[model samples]
Target: MAGTIQRHPVSPVSALRLFFVAGWRSNLALFRWMRPSAFIPTLIGVPALQLIFFVHLGRYLDTQPVSYYALGNALHACAMAGLFAPAMSLAGERFAGTLPALLATPANRTLMFAGRTVTAVLVGCSSTVVMLILGSVLTDFRLPAEGIVPISAAILVTAASCSAFGLLVGAAGLRTREAILLGNLVLYLMLLVCGINIPRESLPDGLRLIGEIMPMTHGIAAARQAFTGSGPVTGLLLVELGKGLSFLVLAVLTLRFLERGSRRAASLDEV
Candidate 1:
Protein backbone atom coordinates (compact mmCIF):
# COMPACT_ATOMS: atom_id res chain seq x y z
CA MET A 1 0.00 0.00 0.00
CA ALA A 2 2.86 2.35 0.72
CA GLY A 3 4.38 1.75 -2.68
CA THR A 4 1.09 1.43 -4.55
CA ILE A 5 -0.55 4.83 -4.92
CA GLN A 6 -3.41 6.06 -7.04
CA ARG A 7 -2.46 8.73 -9.57
CA HIS A 8 -4.21 10.50 -12.40
CA PRO A 9 -2.54 10.00 -15.74
CA VAL A 10 -1.42 13.22 -17.34
CA SER A 11 -1.67 13.76 -21.05
CA PRO A 12 1.39 14.18 -23.25
CA VAL A 13 1.56 17.56 -24.92
CA SER A 14 0.87 17.42 -28.61
CA ALA A 15 3.36 19.18 -30.89
CA LEU A 16 0.89 22.01 -31.36
CA ARG A 17 0.27 22.20 -27.61
CA LEU A 18 3.96 22.69 -26.96
CA PHE A 19 3.81 25.88 -28.95
CA PHE A 20 1.54 27.46 -26.31
CA VAL A 21 3.82 26.67 -23.38
CA ALA A 22 4.96 29.02 -20.61
CA GLY A 23 8.17 29.82 -22.50
CA TRP A 24 6.10 31.59 -25.16
CA ARG A 25 3.95 33.28 -22.51
CA SER A 26 7.10 34.57 -20.87
CA ASN A 27 8.35 35.73 -24.27
CA LEU A 28 5.14 37.69 -24.86
CA ALA A 29 5.42 39.27 -21.44
CA LEU A 30 8.89 40.45 -22.39
CA PHE A 31 7.46 42.14 -25.53
CA ARG A 32 4.72 43.77 -23.47
CA TRP A 33 7.28 44.95 -20.98
CA MET A 34 9.34 46.52 -23.78
CA ARG A 35 6.53 48.93 -24.70
CA PRO A 36 6.73 50.80 -21.39
CA SER A 37 10.49 50.67 -21.22
CA ALA A 38 12.50 52.96 -23.50
CA PHE A 39 12.85 50.11 -26.00
CA ILE A 40 13.20 52.31 -29.12
CA PRO A 41 15.49 54.91 -27.65
CA THR A 42 17.51 52.22 -25.98
CA LEU A 43 18.08 50.43 -29.28
CA ILE A 44 18.78 53.39 -31.52
CA GLY A 45 20.43 55.52 -28.87
CA VAL A 46 23.98 54.27 -29.33
CA PRO A 47 23.59 53.59 -33.04
CA ALA A 48 22.21 57.11 -33.51
CA LEU A 49 25.28 58.42 -31.76
CA GLN A 50 27.29 56.19 -34.11
CA LEU A 51 25.74 57.66 -37.25
CA ILE A 52 26.54 61.15 -36.05
CA PHE A 53 30.07 60.15 -35.05
CA PHE A 54 30.71 58.63 -38.47
CA VAL A 55 29.11 61.47 -40.37
CA HIS A 56 31.43 63.93 -38.63
CA LEU A 57 34.45 61.80 -39.55
CA GLY A 58 33.30 61.41 -43.18
CA ARG A 59 36.38 60.10 -44.99
CA TYR A 60 36.81 57.22 -42.53
CA LEU A 61 35.63 54.03 -44.32
CA ASP A 62 33.29 54.74 -47.19
CA THR A 63 34.72 51.55 -48.69
CA GLN A 64 32.26 49.31 -46.83
CA PRO A 65 28.61 50.11 -47.35
CA VAL A 66 28.21 52.21 -44.21
CA SER A 67 24.54 52.37 -45.11
CA TYR A 68 24.52 48.57 -45.11
CA TYR A 69 26.09 48.58 -41.65
CA ALA A 70 23.04 50.47 -40.42
CA LEU A 71 20.69 47.65 -41.40
CA GLY A 72 23.23 45.03 -40.34
CA ASN A 73 23.42 46.66 -36.93
CA ALA A 74 19.64 46.51 -36.79
CA LEU A 75 19.96 42.73 -37.00
CA HIS A 76 22.85 42.92 -34.56
CA ALA A 77 20.73 44.83 -32.09
CA CYS A 78 18.05 42.16 -32.49
CA ALA A 79 20.11 38.98 -32.57
CA MET A 80 23.22 39.93 -30.63
CA ALA A 81 22.27 40.14 -26.95
CA GLY A 82 19.92 37.18 -27.30
CA LEU A 83 22.84 34.78 -26.98
CA PHE A 84 22.78 35.58 -23.28
CA ALA A 85 19.39 37.07 -22.31
CA PRO A 86 17.68 33.73 -21.76
CA ALA A 87 20.34 32.46 -19.38
CA MET A 88 20.64 35.77 -17.58
CA SER A 89 16.85 36.03 -17.14
CA LEU A 90 16.67 32.41 -16.08
CA ALA A 91 19.36 32.96 -13.49
CA GLY A 92 17.39 35.87 -12.09
CA GLU A 93 14.16 33.86 -12.21
CA ARG A 94 15.82 30.93 -10.51
CA PHE A 95 17.29 33.17 -7.86
CA ALA A 96 13.90 34.80 -7.28
CA GLY A 97 12.23 31.41 -6.91
CA THR A 98 9.97 32.13 -9.88
CA LEU A 99 11.25 29.14 -11.81
CA PRO A 100 9.81 26.69 -9.29
CA ALA A 101 6.36 28.19 -9.58
CA LEU A 102 6.54 28.10 -13.36
CA LEU A 103 7.90 24.57 -13.38
CA ALA A 104 5.21 23.33 -11.01
CA THR A 105 2.65 24.02 -13.68
CA PRO A 106 1.89 21.64 -16.55
CA ALA A 107 4.03 23.81 -18.78
CA ASN A 108 7.23 21.88 -19.39
CA ARG A 109 10.65 23.41 -18.72
CA THR A 110 11.74 23.27 -22.36
CA LEU A 111 8.57 25.01 -23.48
CA MET A 112 9.05 27.76 -20.95
CA PHE A 113 12.61 28.21 -22.17
CA ALA A 114 11.48 28.18 -25.80
CA GLY A 115 8.94 30.93 -25.15
CA ARG A 116 11.57 33.11 -23.49
CA THR A 117 14.00 32.55 -26.37
CA VAL A 118 11.35 33.56 -28.90
CA THR A 119 10.72 36.64 -26.82
CA ALA A 120 14.41 37.54 -26.88
CA VAL A 121 14.54 37.23 -30.68
CA LEU A 122 11.36 39.27 -30.98
CA VAL A 123 12.85 41.99 -28.83
CA GLY A 124 15.98 42.04 -30.99
CA CYS A 125 13.98 42.08 -34.23
CA SER A 126 11.67 44.76 -32.86
CA SER A 127 14.62 46.87 -31.80
CA THR A 128 16.03 46.51 -35.30
CA VAL A 129 12.75 47.61 -36.87
CA VAL A 130 12.75 50.66 -34.64
CA MET A 131 16.30 51.38 -35.65
CA LEU A 132 15.55 50.68 -39.32
CA ILE A 133 12.66 53.16 -39.30
CA LEU A 134 14.73 55.79 -37.58
CA GLY A 135 17.73 55.17 -39.86
CA SER A 136 15.58 55.16 -43.01
CA VAL A 137 13.92 58.40 -42.00
CA LEU A 138 17.09 60.12 -40.90
CA THR A 139 19.46 58.59 -43.46
CA ASP A 140 19.07 57.36 -47.05
CA PHE A 141 19.43 53.62 -46.21
CA ARG A 142 16.90 51.42 -47.95
CA LEU A 143 16.00 47.73 -47.39
CA PRO A 144 14.21 45.68 -50.01
CA ALA A 145 11.10 43.46 -49.85
CA GLU A 146 13.13 40.54 -51.25
CA GLY A 147 15.54 40.62 -48.31
CA ILE A 148 12.79 40.98 -45.72
CA VAL A 149 11.52 37.40 -45.60
CA PRO A 150 14.96 35.77 -45.51
CA ILE A 151 16.30 38.14 -42.89
CA SER A 152 13.27 37.56 -40.68
CA ALA A 153 13.62 33.81 -41.02
CA ALA A 154 17.32 34.02 -40.25
CA ILE A 155 16.74 36.10 -37.12
CA LEU A 156 14.10 33.70 -35.84
CA VAL A 157 16.41 30.74 -36.20
CA THR A 158 19.33 32.57 -34.57
CA ALA A 159 17.02 33.39 -31.68
CA ALA A 160 16.24 29.73 -31.15
CA SER A 161 19.94 28.87 -30.99
CA CYS A 162 20.83 31.69 -28.64
CA SER A 163 17.91 30.67 -26.46
CA ALA A 164 19.42 27.21 -26.26
CA PHE A 165 22.82 28.69 -25.41
CA GLY A 166 21.11 30.73 -22.69
CA LEU A 167 19.62 27.56 -21.25
CA LEU A 168 23.13 26.16 -21.12
CA VAL A 169 24.15 29.20 -19.09
CA GLY A 170 21.18 28.89 -16.75
CA ALA A 171 21.98 25.25 -16.16
CA ALA A 172 25.62 26.03 -15.51
CA GLY A 173 24.52 28.45 -12.79
CA LEU A 174 22.68 25.58 -11.22
CA ARG A 175 26.15 24.16 -10.52
CA THR A 176 28.05 27.22 -9.26
CA ARG A 177 28.16 31.01 -8.88
CA GLU A 178 31.14 31.12 -11.20
CA ALA A 179 28.87 30.06 -14.02
CA ILE A 180 26.76 33.19 -13.67
CA LEU A 181 29.83 35.36 -13.82
CA LEU A 182 31.16 33.53 -16.83
CA GLY A 183 27.78 33.56 -18.50
CA ASN A 184 27.40 37.33 -18.10
CA LEU A 185 30.93 37.87 -19.26
CA VAL A 186 30.57 35.86 -22.45
CA LEU A 187 27.16 37.39 -23.14
CA TYR A 188 28.59 40.88 -23.26
CA LEU A 189 31.71 39.72 -25.03
CA MET A 190 29.59 38.11 -27.71
CA LEU A 191 27.84 41.45 -28.21
CA LEU A 192 31.13 43.11 -28.96
CA VAL A 193 33.26 40.44 -30.61
CA CYS A 194 30.73 38.66 -32.79
CA GLY A 195 30.91 41.33 -35.47
CA ILE A 196 28.31 43.48 -33.74
CA ASN A 197 30.13 46.81 -33.66
CA ILE A 198 33.29 45.82 -35.55
CA PRO A 199 32.86 43.95 -38.79
CA ARG A 200 34.12 40.36 -39.14
CA GLU A 201 36.34 41.76 -41.87
CA SER A 202 38.01 44.04 -39.33
CA LEU A 203 38.66 41.50 -36.57
CA PRO A 204 42.12 39.96 -36.29
CA ASP A 205 42.46 36.42 -37.61
CA GLY A 206 42.25 34.91 -34.10
CA LEU A 207 39.09 36.74 -33.13
CA ARG A 208 37.58 35.89 -36.50
CA LEU A 209 37.68 32.23 -35.53
CA ILE A 210 35.79 33.08 -32.38
CA GLY A 211 33.22 34.95 -34.46
CA GLU A 212 32.59 31.88 -36.55
CA ILE A 213 31.44 29.99 -33.45
CA MET A 214 28.86 32.64 -32.66
CA PRO A 215 25.29 32.16 -33.99
CA MET A 216 25.17 35.88 -34.83
CA THR A 217 27.97 35.47 -37.37
CA HIS A 218 26.01 33.02 -39.48
CA GLY A 219 22.72 34.90 -39.21
CA ILE A 220 24.33 38.26 -39.91
CA ALA A 221 26.24 36.81 -42.84
CA ALA A 222 22.95 35.67 -44.39
CA ALA A 223 21.16 38.89 -43.52
CA ARG A 224 24.01 40.92 -44.99
CA GLN A 225 23.81 38.99 -48.24
CA ALA A 226 20.07 39.53 -48.23
CA PHE A 227 20.65 43.25 -47.82
CA THR A 228 23.40 43.72 -50.44
CA GLY A 229 22.49 41.16 -53.14
CA SER A 230 26.21 41.05 -53.95
CA GLY A 231 26.88 37.36 -53.28
CA PRO A 232 25.21 33.95 -53.46
CA VAL A 233 22.30 33.81 -51.01
CA THR A 234 21.97 30.05 -50.86
CA GLY A 235 25.29 29.36 -49.21
CA LEU A 236 24.80 31.99 -46.53
CA LEU A 237 21.27 30.83 -45.82
CA LEU A 238 22.51 27.25 -45.53
CA VAL A 239 25.11 28.28 -42.99
CA GLU A 240 22.51 30.26 -41.04
CA LEU A 241 20.11 27.33 -41.15
CA GLY A 242 22.72 24.95 -39.80
CA LYS A 243 23.73 27.20 -36.91
CA GLY A 244 20.15 28.00 -35.90
CA LEU A 245 18.96 24.39 -35.93
CA SER A 246 22.11 23.17 -34.20
CA PHE A 247 21.44 25.52 -31.30
CA LEU A 248 17.77 24.50 -31.08
CA VAL A 249 18.67 20.84 -31.05
CA LEU A 250 21.36 21.38 -28.49
CA ALA A 251 19.09 23.55 -26.32
CA VAL A 252 16.31 20.97 -26.32
CA LEU A 253 18.48 18.00 -25.43
CA THR A 254 20.83 19.78 -23.07
CA LEU A 255 18.28 21.91 -21.17
CA ARG A 256 15.88 19.03 -20.61
CA PHE A 257 18.73 17.00 -19.20
CA LEU A 258 19.85 19.91 -17.07
CA GLU A 259 16.30 20.50 -15.92
CA ARG A 260 16.20 17.00 -14.45
CA GLY A 261 19.56 17.53 -12.79
CA SER A 262 18.58 20.90 -11.42
CA ARG A 263 15.43 19.44 -9.92
CA ARG A 264 17.28 16.56 -8.32
CA ALA A 265 19.91 18.87 -6.88
CA ALA A 266 17.22 21.04 -5.23
CA SER A 267 18.57 24.00 -7.10
CA LEU A 268 15.39 24.77 -9.02
CA ASP A 269 13.68 26.55 -6.11
CA GLU A 270 16.88 27.85 -4.56
CA VAL A 271 17.03 30.57 -7.20
Candidate 2:
Protein backbone atom coordinates (compact mmCIF):
# COMPACT_ATOMS: atom_id res chain seq x y z
CA MET A 1 0.00 0.00 0.00
CA ALA A 2 2.78 2.40 0.86
CA GLY A 3 4.61 1.93 -2.47
CA THR A 4 1.57 1.58 -4.65
CA ILE A 5 0.41 4.48 -6.82
CA GLN A 6 -3.30 5.03 -7.08
CA ARG A 7 -3.91 6.23 -10.61
CA HIS A 8 -7.31 7.64 -11.47
CA PRO A 9 -8.76 7.31 -14.94
CA VAL A 10 -8.47 10.50 -16.97
CA SER A 11 -11.88 11.88 -17.81
CA PRO A 12 -12.50 14.97 -19.87
CA VAL A 13 -15.53 15.95 -17.85
CA SER A 14 -13.69 15.53 -14.57
CA ALA A 15 -10.74 17.50 -15.83
CA LEU A 16 -13.04 20.35 -16.78
CA ARG A 17 -14.66 20.20 -13.40
CA LEU A 18 -11.32 20.33 -11.59
CA PHE A 19 -10.11 23.19 -13.75
CA PHE A 20 -13.11 25.37 -13.00
CA VAL A 21 -13.10 24.82 -9.27
CA ALA A 22 -9.36 25.06 -8.68
CA GLY A 23 -8.79 27.86 -11.15
CA TRP A 24 -11.44 30.09 -9.61
CA ARG A 25 -10.12 29.47 -6.10
CA SER A 26 -6.56 30.16 -7.18
CA ASN A 27 -7.54 33.45 -8.82
CA LEU A 28 -9.52 34.54 -5.80
CA ALA A 29 -6.59 33.78 -3.51
CA LEU A 30 -4.28 35.79 -5.74
CA PHE A 31 -6.56 38.83 -5.74
CA ARG A 32 -7.26 38.64 -2.02
CA TRP A 33 -3.61 38.61 -1.01
CA MET A 34 -2.16 41.11 -3.49
CA ARG A 35 -2.60 44.75 -2.50
CA PRO A 36 -4.64 46.84 -4.94
CA SER A 37 -2.16 49.73 -5.30
CA ALA A 38 0.75 47.44 -6.14
CA PHE A 39 -1.33 45.21 -8.41
CA ILE A 40 -2.99 48.05 -10.37
CA PRO A 41 0.30 49.73 -11.21
CA THR A 42 1.86 46.59 -12.61
CA LEU A 43 -1.29 45.42 -14.40
CA ILE A 44 -2.27 48.75 -15.97
CA GLY A 45 -0.09 51.76 -15.15
CA VAL A 46 3.26 50.57 -16.48
CA PRO A 47 1.81 49.40 -19.80
CA ALA A 48 -0.30 52.56 -20.14
CA LEU A 49 2.80 54.74 -19.76
CA GLN A 50 4.57 52.71 -22.42
CA LEU A 51 1.59 53.24 -24.71
CA ILE A 52 1.54 57.02 -24.18
CA PHE A 53 5.28 57.49 -24.55
CA PHE A 54 5.52 55.48 -27.78
CA VAL A 55 2.43 57.11 -29.30
CA HIS A 56 3.75 60.59 -28.53
CA LEU A 57 7.10 59.77 -30.10
CA GLY A 58 5.50 58.12 -33.13
CA ARG A 59 3.30 61.21 -33.69
CA TYR A 60 6.27 63.20 -34.99
CA LEU A 61 7.15 60.63 -37.66
CA ASP A 62 4.08 58.64 -38.74
CA THR A 63 0.75 60.00 -39.93
CA GLN A 64 -1.16 57.17 -38.16
CA PRO A 65 0.97 56.92 -35.06
CA VAL A 66 -2.06 56.73 -32.80
CA SER A 67 -3.34 53.58 -34.52
CA TYR A 68 0.07 51.89 -34.44
CA TYR A 69 0.98 52.64 -30.84
CA ALA A 70 -2.51 52.19 -29.45
CA LEU A 71 -2.97 48.64 -30.77
CA GLY A 72 0.65 47.64 -30.35
CA ASN A 73 0.75 48.68 -26.71
CA ALA A 74 -2.60 47.08 -26.04
CA LEU A 75 -1.19 43.76 -27.20
CA HIS A 76 1.94 44.46 -25.17
CA ALA A 77 -0.19 44.97 -22.11
CA CYS A 78 -1.91 41.63 -22.74
CA ALA A 79 1.45 39.94 -23.24
CA MET A 80 2.71 41.27 -19.92
CA ALA A 81 -0.35 40.02 -18.08
CA GLY A 82 -0.45 36.62 -19.78
CA LEU A 83 3.29 36.05 -19.63
CA PHE A 84 4.42 37.23 -16.19
CA ALA A 85 1.47 36.83 -13.82
CA PRO A 86 0.90 33.12 -14.44
CA ALA A 87 4.60 32.28 -14.15
CA MET A 88 4.85 34.20 -10.92
CA SER A 89 1.77 32.41 -9.59
CA LEU A 90 3.28 29.01 -10.33
CA ALA A 91 6.58 30.01 -8.77
CA GLY A 92 4.68 31.31 -5.76
CA GLU A 93 3.09 27.89 -5.33
CA ARG A 94 6.55 26.38 -4.98
CA PHE A 95 7.56 28.89 -2.33
CA ALA A 96 4.19 28.52 -0.61
CA GLY A 97 4.73 24.75 -0.18
CA THR A 98 1.78 23.85 -2.43
CA LEU A 99 3.79 22.51 -5.36
CA PRO A 100 4.40 19.07 -3.87
CA ALA A 101 0.80 18.47 -2.96
CA LEU A 102 -0.28 19.78 -6.32
CA LEU A 103 2.05 17.44 -8.17
CA ALA A 104 1.08 14.50 -6.00
CA THR A 105 -2.59 14.82 -6.80
CA PRO A 106 -4.29 12.48 -9.29
CA ALA A 107 -5.27 15.46 -11.42
CA ASN A 108 -3.19 16.12 -14.53
CA ARG A 109 -0.73 18.94 -13.94
CA THR A 110 -0.93 20.16 -17.51
CA LEU A 111 -4.70 20.49 -17.32
CA MET A 112 -4.38 22.24 -14.00
CA PHE A 113 -1.98 24.66 -15.62
CA ALA A 114 -4.40 25.22 -18.47
CA GLY A 115 -7.14 25.88 -15.99
CA ARG A 116 -5.01 28.56 -14.42
CA THR A 117 -4.58 30.11 -17.86
CA VAL A 118 -8.31 30.92 -18.01
CA THR A 119 -7.75 33.73 -15.53
CA ALA A 120 -4.59 34.86 -17.30
CA VAL A 121 -6.39 35.18 -20.60
CA LEU A 122 -9.30 37.02 -19.00
CA VAL A 123 -7.03 39.47 -17.18
CA GLY A 124 -4.90 40.01 -20.27
CA CYS A 125 -7.93 40.75 -22.42
CA SER A 126 -9.40 43.08 -19.81
CA SER A 127 -6.12 45.01 -19.61
CA THR A 128 -6.00 45.39 -23.37
CA VAL A 129 -9.60 46.64 -23.60
CA VAL A 130 -8.97 49.21 -20.87
CA MET A 131 -5.86 50.46 -22.68
CA LEU A 132 -7.68 50.61 -26.00
CA ILE A 133 -10.52 52.69 -24.51
CA LEU A 134 -8.14 54.98 -22.64
CA GLY A 135 -5.86 55.39 -25.66
CA SER A 136 -8.81 56.15 -27.91
CA VAL A 137 -10.09 58.85 -25.56
CA LEU A 138 -6.77 60.60 -25.06
CA THR A 139 -5.19 60.10 -28.51
CA ASP A 140 -8.22 60.55 -30.80
CA PHE A 141 -7.91 57.04 -32.18
CA ARG A 142 -11.05 55.23 -33.28
CA LEU A 143 -11.83 51.54 -32.90
CA PRO A 144 -12.98 49.87 -36.09
CA ALA A 145 -16.69 49.08 -36.11
CA GLU A 146 -16.53 46.54 -38.94
CA GLY A 147 -13.79 44.31 -37.47
CA ILE A 148 -15.00 44.02 -33.89
CA VAL A 149 -15.38 40.25 -34.00
CA PRO A 150 -12.00 39.78 -35.68
CA ILE A 151 -10.35 42.03 -33.13
CA SER A 152 -11.87 40.04 -30.30
CA ALA A 153 -10.63 36.82 -31.88
CA ALA A 154 -7.18 38.35 -32.26
CA ILE A 155 -7.08 39.26 -28.58
CA LEU A 156 -8.01 35.73 -27.58
CA VAL A 157 -5.28 34.30 -29.79
CA THR A 158 -2.71 36.69 -28.36
CA ALA A 159 -3.69 35.79 -24.83
CA ALA A 160 -3.51 32.09 -25.64
CA SER A 161 -0.05 32.39 -27.15
CA CYS A 162 1.38 34.46 -24.33
CA SER A 163 -0.17 32.20 -21.71
CA ALA A 164 1.34 29.14 -23.38
CA PHE A 165 4.73 30.81 -23.30
CA GLY A 166 4.09 31.62 -19.66
CA LEU A 167 3.61 27.91 -18.94
CA LEU A 168 7.12 27.29 -20.20
CA VAL A 169 8.42 30.10 -18.03
CA GLY A 170 6.55 28.71 -15.03
CA ALA A 171 7.94 25.24 -15.58
CA ALA A 172 11.45 26.63 -15.83
CA GLY A 173 10.89 28.71 -12.71
CA LEU A 174 10.51 25.48 -10.81
CA ARG A 175 14.23 25.03 -11.34
CA THR A 176 15.81 28.50 -11.05
CA ARG A 177 15.23 32.22 -10.58
CA GLU A 178 16.88 32.76 -13.94
CA ALA A 179 13.71 31.54 -15.64
CA ILE A 180 11.65 34.51 -14.39
CA LEU A 181 14.48 36.82 -15.45
CA LEU A 182 14.37 35.17 -18.84
CA GLY A 183 10.63 35.86 -19.03
CA ASN A 184 11.28 39.59 -18.51
CA LEU A 185 13.95 39.53 -21.20
CA VAL A 186 11.53 37.86 -23.60
CA LEU A 187 8.86 40.55 -22.95
CA TYR A 188 11.24 43.38 -23.87
CA LEU A 189 12.54 41.47 -26.85
CA MET A 190 8.97 41.06 -28.08
CA LEU A 191 8.46 44.82 -27.88
CA LEU A 192 11.56 45.45 -29.97
CA VAL A 193 11.27 42.65 -32.51
CA CYS A 194 7.59 41.75 -32.57
CA GLY A 195 6.57 44.94 -34.32
CA ILE A 196 5.22 46.50 -31.14
CA ASN A 197 6.66 49.93 -32.02
CA ILE A 198 8.77 49.19 -35.13
CA PRO A 199 7.67 47.31 -38.22
CA ARG A 200 8.96 43.74 -38.44
CA GLU A 201 10.31 44.40 -41.93
CA SER A 202 12.63 47.09 -40.57
CA LEU A 203 13.99 44.94 -37.72
CA PRO A 204 17.06 43.87 -39.71
CA ASP A 205 17.13 40.34 -41.17
CA GLY A 206 18.18 38.54 -38.00
CA LEU A 207 15.76 40.31 -35.70
CA ARG A 208 13.04 39.99 -38.29
CA LEU A 209 13.53 36.24 -38.28
CA ILE A 210 13.20 36.27 -34.49
CA GLY A 211 10.03 38.35 -34.64
CA GLU A 212 8.34 35.86 -36.96
CA ILE A 213 8.54 33.21 -34.24
CA MET A 214 7.64 35.41 -31.29
CA PRO A 215 4.11 34.87 -29.91
CA MET A 216 2.63 38.34 -30.33
CA THR A 217 4.21 39.18 -33.69
CA HIS A 218 1.54 37.57 -35.82
CA GLY A 219 -1.13 38.32 -33.25
CA ILE A 220 -0.26 42.03 -33.34
CA ALA A 221 -0.31 41.94 -37.11
CA ALA A 222 -3.70 40.32 -37.06
CA ALA A 223 -5.00 42.80 -34.54
CA ARG A 224 -3.73 45.72 -36.60
CA GLN A 225 -5.31 44.37 -39.76
CA ALA A 226 -8.55 43.86 -37.91
CA PHE A 227 -8.37 47.40 -36.62
CA THR A 228 -7.77 48.89 -40.06
CA GLY A 229 -9.82 46.33 -42.03
CA SER A 230 -6.74 46.05 -44.23
CA GLY A 231 -5.89 42.32 -44.50
CA PRO A 232 -7.46 38.86 -44.30
CA VAL A 233 -8.31 38.56 -40.63
CA THR A 234 -9.21 34.86 -40.61
CA GLY A 235 -5.90 33.72 -42.04
CA LEU A 236 -3.80 35.85 -39.70
CA LEU A 237 -5.87 34.99 -36.65
CA LEU A 238 -5.63 31.29 -37.46
CA VAL A 239 -1.86 31.55 -37.81
CA GLU A 240 -1.63 33.29 -34.46
CA LEU A 241 -3.82 30.63 -32.86
CA GLY A 242 -1.58 27.93 -34.30
CA LYS A 243 1.48 29.56 -32.80
CA GLY A 244 -0.16 29.70 -29.37
CA LEU A 245 -1.20 26.05 -29.47
CA SER A 246 2.28 25.03 -30.56
CA PHE A 247 3.80 26.84 -27.60
CA LEU A 248 1.33 25.11 -25.32
CA VAL A 249 2.37 21.71 -26.67
CA LEU A 250 5.98 22.65 -26.07
CA ALA A 251 5.15 23.66 -22.52
CA VAL A 252 3.41 20.32 -21.96
CA LEU A 253 6.47 18.46 -23.18
CA THR A 254 8.71 20.55 -20.97
CA LEU A 255 6.53 19.86 -17.95
CA ARG A 256 6.45 16.15 -18.73
CA PHE A 257 10.23 16.05 -19.03
CA LEU A 258 10.61 17.76 -15.68
CA GLU A 259 8.13 15.42 -14.02
CA ARG A 260 9.78 12.32 -15.45
CA GLY A 261 13.15 13.45 -14.16
CA SER A 262 11.81 14.03 -10.67
CA ARG A 263 13.38 11.77 -8.02
CA ARG A 264 11.63 9.34 -5.70
CA ALA A 265 10.39 10.99 -2.49
CA ALA A 266 12.17 14.14 -3.64
CA SER A 267 10.12 14.77 -6.76
CA LEU A 268 9.55 18.49 -6.28
CA ASP A 269 13.20 18.99 -5.35
CA GLU A 270 14.36 17.41 -8.60
CA VAL A 271 12.01 19.57 -10.68
- Estimate TM-scores for all models: 0.75, 0.92
Q: How does each model score on lDDT?
A: 0.62, 0.80
Question: In candidate 2, what are the lDDT values of residues 1-271, reduced to their tens digit?
Answer: 7855587777888888887778767766755525777768988899889888888888877855678988899888998878876687677677667777777777777778777777888889999988888889778888778878888888888988998888788777666656678789999999899998988776699999989888988888988998887778888778888888888888888877776565343646433
Question: On residues 195-243, what C-alpha lDDT tens digit does candidate 1 reach at each position?
Answer: 6556778778888888787666777677777777766566766776676
Model 1, runs deviating above 4 Å: 1-15, 27-35, 38-63, 101-107, 177-184
Candidate 1: which pairs clash? 23-112, 23-115, 24-115, 78-124, 94-271, 95-271
Candidate 1 lDDT: 0.62
CA shift of 226, model 2, Å: 1.5
- How big is the positional error of residue 145 in model 2, measured in Å on the Cα after superposition? 0.8
Q: What is the lDDT of residue 149 in candidate 1?
A: 81
Error of 1 at 56 (Å): 6.4
> Which window of 10 residues has the lowest lDDT sum in candidate 2?
262-271
On a 0 to 1 TM-score scale, where does candidate 2 land against the true structure? Answer: 0.92
Q: How many residue pairs clash in each candidate?
A: 6, 0
